[model samples]
Target: MLIGEVARRSGVSARMLRHYDSLGLVRPTGRTVGGYREYSAEDMRRILCVEGLRSLGLSLRQIGRALEDPACTPSALVGDLIRWAEDRLEREQELLERLRTVDASAPSGWQGVLRIVELMHGLNSPSAARRQQAVLAPAEDVRVPTELLAGAVLAESDPNVAGALRWALARAGSDAVASVVSGAYSENVDIRRRAVLAIAEMSGDEATAVLADALRDSDPTVRRHAALASGTRGVTAAVPTLVGMVVEGTNDVEAAEVLGRLSLDPECADRIMAALVDELAAHSADSAVRIRLTQALVEMSGTIAQGVLGQLAHDGDRAVALIASASLRPVRVVGLPDDESCDDAGRRHPSQVLRR
Candidate 1:
């Protein structure tokens, strides 16, 4: 196949194919006398496997070994990468401490070494002014240092460092975007959650989709954080999926809160159907959750309010009624759409269903 055909089949750019060839990770089995590279089907499969391992964060050297040795476990490679990441984080901490120790104005015998360390730190620090210049500068001049900064910042102990790195990366655009996700799929939940939030904030479509996947995270708090971040991004594409999770998933009050928040939007109300309201109203669940759901409804009063409240009131469970009653107590603010929540705040506004 030609490079374009290979690029289309493998989703690896033509330029990247050339890069793989230079690295000897994937090379054409034969070359024309004029030196144009042609790929056989076997070569294309090899390139795809390389792409997959790369997606898993294997270094080309590391992936080469795994590909060459079928017994090698990719999981072991992941562990090695994680340790490598931790080592970098520790180095970042040490460097930050060393920088803090070196008083800029101090006179010292080790001034030269201190200055060198300071220079390395300076190279690490990216300023907003420098980043803006990269945006306007010609591509030849745009050495935005994206991978350097992203690697340095995988776990910066300071927001100042991370924020500066993020700005510098904005100069590099979507290419810089993948670094956030590279960290997200790691075994670390905290790492994944933070990466997911950072990516969602960057307004990247790939990041938005990946963050939604993180909502199924084992760490409820991470899932909650990821869910809220995705919802806040207004990626309504995730609304239907979130709606099902809210309606059926148990012990996921935070997910429910985010779902309720998203569905409160006029167009999303229908997705927050009676099943979801009942699930939220189910007193068996956490009270904190019921409160959040009621609060969400109060914030989005309309037909949703009337329908949810009326259902709660007519149900045999007076428990929901009590929650609704509490919601109505302040009727000053939207109350929990508990059963009796509306008895006091009742259909006074006339039951309104948000038109689809």
Candidate 2:
């Protein structure tokens, strides 16, 4: 067949066919009287093969090697092709996400677009300081989108940068809750942990609802963070986890403080006191645990917790007895810098006395 006929039938442009011939990928098998290139049946098959491989994202050199090298096997080359294709796909997906974030911002003009682009670049920067600055940068005119801040919060690993991102998300308020909540359910433990932490800083019923769900997370860290945040928001469901933290000595002081605050509600007070008493009974053999619980009781109203403190004051453990007895006393001031009375009674904050 003539090159023109082959081009017409095969859909390969004549220019491309000539280029393929020069590369020896598919040379014409013969020539006509006018010296035009002529393709044989075998040449047509070779042209089809090159196009087939090209469709699989093969480079021209790779196609030539694949067609000409007898020792080159399809298995290894196809595997390499698969990896390259995957890399390209990942790049495209990342680009798509960036575009979506920018579009979601609804930039007013090219200047707005450039500002967002710069912010995104900073957020994705390798340097943690740059990422932090990206989040903390002044944006009086151009408000950073909540989605962008939430995304950065979930992905940030550095402690300082992660905190800054969470702060930014908090400032974004409930608008960022959904994005951060999605991260709360992420398969990655770190991502889930970050998600809960970010959501914990957010306010509003929506954030509180997300935290309530997060309390059931399998990861203990996620649950602890959720419990703390939820408890502060008056979600009574956090009471159990907060009590457990006291027992486990994981942020026990803060947990106890939250529990004490929760106890302000008369009904919640009964439940809080009951949970604390139960923990005290459960850990009767552990002096350190009992001591911590004793300190936690001080946060409760003196009227409700006085009876329990009286009984604990006479407990077998000397340290528990001293702490409880001190708690029972009506010191002129508690938790004050110049309250020498607390020092005179050898009383200290639970956090100061317990390492665990």
Candidate 3:
């Protein structure tokens, strides 16, 4: 078959077929009387093979070798081709993500577009300092898109950079809340922790709700952070976890302080006092646990806790009794209504005299 016929039948352009000939990938097996190149049946098979390898993303040089080199095995060449295609796909995917992020920002001009591009590059920089600077630099003047910051914050590993990114995300406000919440459900433990941390800094009921949901996370650290943040936000759902933190002595001080704040309301005060007292009773056999619980009671406000403290003062555990007695002294419940009083009457005199 002549080159034109082969081009017509194979869909490989004549010029490309001639180029293949020049590269020795598919040489014409014969020539006509007019010196026109003619391809034999074997040449047609070779042409088909070249097109087949090219379809697999092989370079022209690679295709030439696959067709000509006896040592270049098909398995090895195909394996390299697969890797090369994967690398290209990965790079293209990254580019697509960048474009999508830029599009999401809806930049006002080329300058705005350039700013986002630079910010993205900085966030992904291998240098931790560069990532840190990228997160911090936006504070001065650059306005990074909240979505970008939300994504970066989840993936950030450096403590300083992660903190700065969370600050930036917080400053971005509720606009990034969806992204942060999405991260809260991520399979990655670190991402979930970061998501809760980011949400903790954010205000609004949505952020609070996200933290509330995170309180049940399988990861203890995630649950602990979420519980503390939620308690600070006055989510009543955090009560159980906050109470547990006191018993476990993990961030027990902050947990107690947050519980105290949550107890400012009359209703919450009674519930919190009950929780602490219950935990105190449950851990009665463990002196160290009892001591932490006894100290945690100091964070609670209102006379409801004073009665519990009074009873605890005479407990079987000497350390518990000493700590509770000390806690009972000079104690005043700040938010109790005048009508409200401790459940035990005998303890009332100490509460009354203490209230005075």
Clashes of each: 13, 0, 0
Which ten-residue region of model 1 has the weakest summed lDDT? Answer: 134-143
- Which pairs, if any, clash in model 3? none
* lDDT at 175, model 1: 66
Order by TM-score, highest first:
2, 3, 1
List where candidate 1 sits over 4 angstroms from the true fold.
1-144, 157-172, 235-261, 264-268, 284-287, 310-356
Clashing pairs in 2: none
How many clashes in candidate 3?
Answer: 0
Is 1 or 3 the stronger prediction by TM-score?
A: 3
Q: Which candidate is the best by lDDT?
A: 2
For model 3, the superposed segments whose C-alpha errors exceed 4 Å read 71-75, 139-142, 314-322, 331-356
Report residue 355 deviation for candidate 3 (angstroms): 17
Poorest lDDT segment (10 consecutive residues) of candidate 2: 347-356
Please report the TM-score between candidate 3 and the true structure.
Answer: 0.86
lDDT of 2 at 193: 94
